[model samples]
Target: MTCGLFQILMISFFHLIELSSQQETRFVYETFRGQENLYLDGSATVLPSGLLQLTNALHHQMAHVFYKESIGLSSSRQLSFSTHFVCALVPQPGVEGGHGMAFVVSPSMDFSHAESTRYLGIFNVSKNGSPSSHVLAVELDTIWNPDFEDIDHNHVGIDVNSPLSVGIASASYYSDIKGKNESINLLSGNPLQVWVDYEGNMLNVSMAPCEVQKPSRPLLSQHINLSDIFPNRRLFVGFSAATGTAISYHYILSWSFSTSRGSLQRLDISRLPEVPHPRSEHKNLSPLFIVLLGFLAIMGFCTLTGMYFFRRSKYAEVTEAWEEEFGAHRFSYKSLYKATKGLTRMDFLEEEVLEKSTEEISFQTEK
Candidate 1:
């Protein structure tokens, strides 16, 4: 009798699971603007222009932004999701390439265990390739990493838990007119629209420049069972960016996600926030440089003031042309000062008389 009851309960649970899988969740961010629905960490922030700026031109740093709430069907263990977003990867000044960014679906928001690196905040060297990670990342990588077995320096990859990609392709799109694969520069600083769709066991990633619409063919595609990856069928979606020795700025102008096929919200490219130029109106001077500049200014001011006072206090005797012409017959103030500096006038007169007498005696001897 107990076994019969257990069988009935199991059947009812299966029926509930079937019903739960039909629930759809949608999140669209046309512009962050004044919205506070995202949880940001590290160097992530929303620009005043309603853009999501991830990492700045800082090296060895990482930043991330996630939806404030977890996204998943509460009663289902399988989810078919699609996401669309417009993003920009601007190269730092004079930098050719850089570490990259990723669109990640993680089980939890706590990534302290995985230190940021070439992994793009997905996993560390130790945690990578471990099934326990339960992370899915669509990487838009710029820097070539041999450790991760990257295909090239500029490419898009589908990473499950490790930086190593299961499906990879150059950063480009298929042209219907050309009937071939054409390459695109990922670090061109231009906005690009990306679509990630996962239905059944197939995952597709497609992208094109903002000017170009979605291509008929995907840039890269692969078949992977997401249900097995997400043990609990729950996920959190976000953007993760990392920098190495090189620097780059990652940005997201808009993003939308949906569980229904072909129903992902489209971004308003015309109204999207612009990616600020690589060089701002003013340069960013470091704190140390500012302090040194201030110190130098203070020292220069002190030196100038000291010199001005010294010149003012020193004595200067000015002699006119008339004084110079008749100085032999006239007693100038300088002559008076010399005669009166130490000896009295009477003593000076006596010296002059002795000199005259000596001259007279010499003249008589000569005669």
Candidate 2:
């Protein structure tokens, strides 16, 4: 009986090793230079330095990026998983940037039914809230999507099967020193790190500047079960990004993921690629330019006004006492001045002579 029990114990130990090996999923792409294991579609591309760029500076576009191999999610028990990625969202300067990117985990990479724009290329309008979709996402949304009932224009959300979030919070990070939440703008055009971990039916999402270490307190901590999303299959982890009328370039500088809590590799900040800074879109008129324009406008108005009054003044007549003897036949000097057009006074004498001659002829005929 002792020998039989020993053999069974040995068998059980080997079986445990096999399951552990299968459950272990680890990958690191500090830079994607020569790696081809990533499956990119639509607008996704791997830059020269292994930077994963999803969606271009163009609008109304979508992209998907996924790891070639799938990671198994155990059905018998809830497994632990952690992933961290550094991303930089460089938006077109001087314009509102839309729709953002999401770290997605899906059982199937065939996003044929998905639509771009506010959907983040994950699902279409018709399937956004369907109960069967089992899509898990951590979205860093820049545009306010009223359709999804988004809380604000800039927020991070935990979504299941829909862009509409189960839990949402404005983009922010908890500062240990300040002991409060500090707001973060997702479109700030700076490289930032996002960490997601799921263990014991709890999902925690945290973010911080690339230079700072992970904070003790996460930005979001909510209960979630991965087993419920994918009951008996492996899931592919990747990113989905889309742009609407507003455009932004979404880039993943570095990424690392593992199904084990402490074994997940840390992203090397020093070796990571630099974020592309956006140009200053809010153009301000130079004070000198404004002053110059104002000076020119004032000078133009003053010069024209002065010239107008001066010309009118030249036609001003005092109406001497002798002028009233003509009664109704009297013409005002201003009328004659206007008829002369401010020049050629000699022509006025000839014009008056012709008029007097005609008047005399008419008077003689009447007599």
Candidate 3:
């Protein structure tokens, strides 16, 4: 009856949920790339330093590079990618830096109309905020874009088909010890990593230094559907950057991409060089410290052994003393029987009568 119908409905609902979860876990495309697969344009080059340089410190320059194929992005699917990159602003005398770089997905690989500066070389000024641009970007912005009403000069932002970020978070890392966000200079020439994920109509962006672990909390996350903007579901994936009067070097050391219809996997860090650290600033334990540690270890062992033997010897001495004192007083059963008088009723009565007669005679004599 009604209960049966309700049960059927519940079963259908659970099945739908299970299907959704399965779709979310699937990846349609998954691959990794190094410098060889990255196609560079404009000022971008494969540096001898093993980084795919997107832009040099030249003024009013724009560079856009993308992979050779068109990636599919569907409404029901999750798409994710990560980039290991570094951007360093080259300070010049009395010159201002324009903008930073972006991980972008666009309709085509052509950047002929893409402008530099605040546009990040992905969109021109005319189409910067237009809905028809058909572009999705995660920006690592260095300079503030006043016209766009940016939250801060340095931040991570999620952009959908426009330069305006639907959501933004100041570029920072999660400090596990502090349990809070710790700001870092993005233009400090340090290698950084960023993850971009689009799942169930939400776009999430997370960033941190290469030396630091990836923060669980995404810097910027927003709800958006790519199907609305990208009807064809095919798009070009790559990076873009621009320099205004100010300049910087933009590089991508490695990149990994995956789609929701495939297995979830982490970015392959082995293909890239380890993040650079200063050797001179590094410190290790001194020889004196090692010697002290060894001495303390030996002393601790000796103390433990001494305490163990001391307690054992003390216990043995107590046991021996107890046995010696108790063993010496043990007497035979015959001596105990004499102390209590023999178990004979007639002898006990005769002894008692004799004592009474003696007592009576003594009393008469006294009288």
Candidate 4:
């Protein structure tokens, strides 16, 4: 009886350990296949290339796509997420790029008031400095806004409940496999990877080119308490982007998120899928190029229409002026034919000669 009791106690302890492991294993992952579980708003769409595009050739457009199901982010627990993506911003030659794109965890996924261009489709002019808007976003900004006091035209910004950045870093990546640092242009139209982890009171953001391994040192590390910022435990995770007169093509190749309060290893890295080959920047035409082509076509059509109306108006003016001078009684073809005996001047002259010759011949015969 003593041996049996000891064996039952051991079984119960092992069962409790198994339950704890299962509870911390929740994960959310997606490769954006056919816009499966995503909610698209505005210009967002799944392209034929299998990339999830947030915005297309439109100007003054704001677009975003969020997970249909809300992510259960706990204010008390730690969370880690890694996104593997590629973005191509083809701005007009002399003009600026877009406001930017951001990975956001917000109280709600609605962005109806977000403005285009410098606002990044995450917030509008009214919400820029507002305190009530609760949000945490990692922005890949390609343009500089004087209102936000951006450090440069190209940088990555980490924001808490505001469009103003708490921290900013010029976009760069490690060059060598041995972790030698190199600063490359962020908007060079290459693929990049960004990792965000929140553990304890620290938030770390690391970024690198897709070719290099993940960097050991984070570009930006700051201390903040998530519980204070986000009183609401539940949040929505997704992406947002916008364009003013400028434009860009924002894409999400793959993404994975884990809600585990345990080690980062517990979060499955294998769930993150591989991205497709980087698209050729030269092969893909600029959104401005397409816009210019459309504009020229419309202008050509308008010019032709104006010319047709102008000619029609000028002809009408001449006819009206002539009618005003002469009392509206116009010569008809039938009246003219009767007045000249249906004969031209040459025909009338020949007929007159024939009649005179016949009369002369009759006179000679009588003589």
Q: Return the top candidate by lDDT.
A: 2
**Top candidate, metric TM-score:** 2
Instruction: Encode model 2's per-residue lDDT on 61-94: one tens digit a residue.
Output: 8999898999876545677889999998888877
Q: Mind giving the per-residue lDDT tens digits that candidate 4 earns over 1-367?
A: 9999999999989876555433443334344665567778988877665557776557888888787766544433454444434444444433455767888878788888777788888877766767677778888898887778798888888888787899888877655565565775655655566777776767777777666666778887888666666676556778888887877666665565555434333223344444333443456679999999999999999999999998666434234676887879766544555687675557879999999999999999999
Per-prediction CA RMSD (Å): 12.3, 11.7, 23.6, 12.3
User: Tens digit of lDDT per residue, candidate 3, span 43-160?
Assistant: 8776555556677657888888787766665445544543333334333323454488998888788888888878888887778777778888888888887677788887888887
Ten-residue stretch with the least lDDT total in model 1: 310-319
Q: Mark the regions of model 2 whose C-alpha exceeds 4 Å error after superposition.
A: 1-21, 278-288, 294-367
Q: Quote model 3's TM-score.
A: 0.61
Provide the clash count, candidate 2. 1
lDDT comparison, 1 vs 3, better candidate: 1
Q: In model 1, how large is the Cα lDDT of residue 97?
A: 53
Badly placed stretches (over 4 Å) of model 4 are 1-30, 73-95, 175-180, 261-367
Misplaced by over 4 Å in model 3 are 1-36, 74-98, 261-367
What is the descending lDDT order? 2, 1, 3, 4
Worst 10 residues of 4 by lDDT: 261-270
- Candidate 1, residue 241: how far the Cα is off, in Å: 0.4
> Between which residue pairs do clashes occur in model 4?
none
Clash totals for all candidate models: 0, 1, 7, 0
